[model samples]
Target: MSQPAAATNAFLVATQRALDYAGFAPPSPGATCVLVFDSTLWNTHIASVHGLLNAVEQARAMRFRFERDREPYAVGHAVWRIVLAACLNVPISAVPLVSTASGQPHLPGTRWVTSLSHSGSWVAIAVGEADCIGVDIERSPSQMNLSALMPRFCTPAECVQLSGLPTPLRETRLLALWTRKEALLKAFGTGLNEDPASMAAAENTIVAAPASCGRTAVCHVRDLDLPASLVGALAVPAGAMSHRLYWLDRCSNDVYGCNSAETSIRSN
Candidate 1:
């Protein structure tokens, strides 16, 4: 084969391999698929993944000012495109993802609602058929002054509940609650522009929507099962729906090799 043809063929093979490793199956109708991956695992393929991004994403990646931040942004967005392509049944490059004024990413004319979040080295993406959807993953901090933050984001009732817990448990629950609130706000496409303390994120229950969100609508928050160091949550408009979780990781023996493990999380 000619040299250029050979390179193109190799690229195609590698792309298929990565997709297979990610287990890029479409979410079941009316369900969301949440994929969490360590962006650091894609470090070796940064150049290749960077190539998958569009101009806007490329410019955004360039503005990161630090390599550590840039790599994950590139890798995360590349994986996001891969997931979106699978959902839309299109090639990765064809996914027309755009960000809203508040910075929530979505497909312009599609019914699919999407959200992305990254913390430390982990990135999480959510795709589903819903009125709106949001997902967030956060690495628990080793130490933080919860007392200084609670009043800013926690509701009065949440403060009372958390105040009764032991220190360690309170810290963990605090992060979980933060993720839930973030996810809910992102789903509304208002982000932190609305006060996070306005609504309480009680698990498995419908919480009153913020002023930016329609007064009649409510949000349902559910915590996600993640590795001990990380906490995650998903939010959607109040209703019945399902979600599937997948973990994408690199093989220990080969930096270029990839694999995925499916994690089943029961609904609340």
Candidate 2:
């Protein structure tokens, strides 16, 4: 009989290809992590969740918050906590999963900050000691009404640039543009309420913050080299410094890079 799939194999073989594009490197003085989850692995991990969290507070929070939820979401929540613990070299239970008034997550007293994104069978989390970070990923939007959606979010220039693309390329580019805009909004704690058209940032456009905050906040964004089936973007404050990437399940280092189905596991 044929052997079963690798217990930790990614759902898409193409995802492996995407990682090559991600540009993984080792951690520096300020740590950064990219936690990728396999759909096939989540089911197995959930049953083993019995002792994942390590602190009384974290344990209590999981019991009331994460455990009560259903699969994938719950599993993803657990993974988020796990990523925090893994990066900090602390017990999963010792990591305090708290959010600010704007709903961005933080480690409370620690130097690490984070952003999460999930699409189809994949979940990705980027953590660093930068002022803030936001990451997003999505499946190719072949099913969406892109023509209808572009104007709502794409600035005129962005629209024209997208329009000039071949039919297939346009959709991916637009979705990627939207993904970067979403990442920036998440970084700024505005979510989608802020107009994406004005906020859009492309590979060439790093985007400027609003008139508020003296516009001193710098947004640095870039496209990830992911599979054609997916698109993604990473947004961090300009002074974030260097970053590294890792695979969560193996705790192994990862290097490179996609857009739209944004963070399925993140509540805010």
Candidate 3:
């Protein structure tokens, strides 16, 4: 086989092995599946995965000035396509993933809704049959200027709640709150274009759409239990009662570089 063809075959085989290792399952009615993967796992296979991206995604990945930014973007989108393909039972290239003007991705003409977020080394993808869905993952920074950001994103009440905590606790809580609000905004499809302060950050609470949204919506936001260094959240229309989370990391065997015995599936 030609070098390019051989690389493509290797990626395809690896993707299948990963899915099989995870015992991957599609999201069902009333539930969403959030897959979190370490993008670095694909570092050695960048060429193989880059071939999986569409022209637009390829151009966007190339636009990144540094390999640090470029590699993750390619790996994230490639894995996203793989997951969606498995869910729809189609070839990876056949998944009709498209982005809105604001860059939130979705499956055009399909029942499945998708939202993607990445932070530090991790990339998260949420998929389900909800009217709308959003997922966000953020790595906690060692330091931040909380005073400068809190007012911009937090409501008066939220600010009060966060301020009452000690500095360390406050910073941690704030990051968690930020993820929830971002997820909710993405689910509303307005992203940060809408005033984040207009929505509260309380978990499992119904969030009303901001006046600028020009429509009424009740979104449910929940905190995701992730590794200590990372905070994540999911937002879906109220109808979606729960979600399942799967961590996709490299296994020790390292041949396929996709499976992980440590992979965990959590439902809530």
Please give the CA lDDT of all the candidate structures.
0.78, 0.60, 0.80
Model 2: per-residue Cα lDDT over 171-222, one tens digit each: 7777888778877887776676577877658663456675542346667777
Sorting all predicted structures by TM-score, with the top scorer first, yields: 3, 1, 2
Candidate 3 ranges with C-alpha deviation above 4 Å = 255-268
Q: For candidate 1, lDDT tens digit of each residue in 170-207?
A: 88889888889899888888889999888788766676
Segments in model 2 whose C-alpha atoms lie over 4 Å from true places: 1-26, 50-70, 212-215, 247-268
Q: Score residue 221 of candidate 1 by CA lDDT.
A: 78
lDDT: which candidate is best? 3
Q: Which lDDT tens digits does candidate 3 get at residues 154-183?
A: 999998878878888888888888899999
Evaluated at residue 212, the lDDT of candidate 2 is 40
* Every model's TM-score: 0.87, 0.71, 0.91
* Clash count, one per candidate: 0, 21, 0
- Candidate 3 least-lDDT 10 residues: 258-267
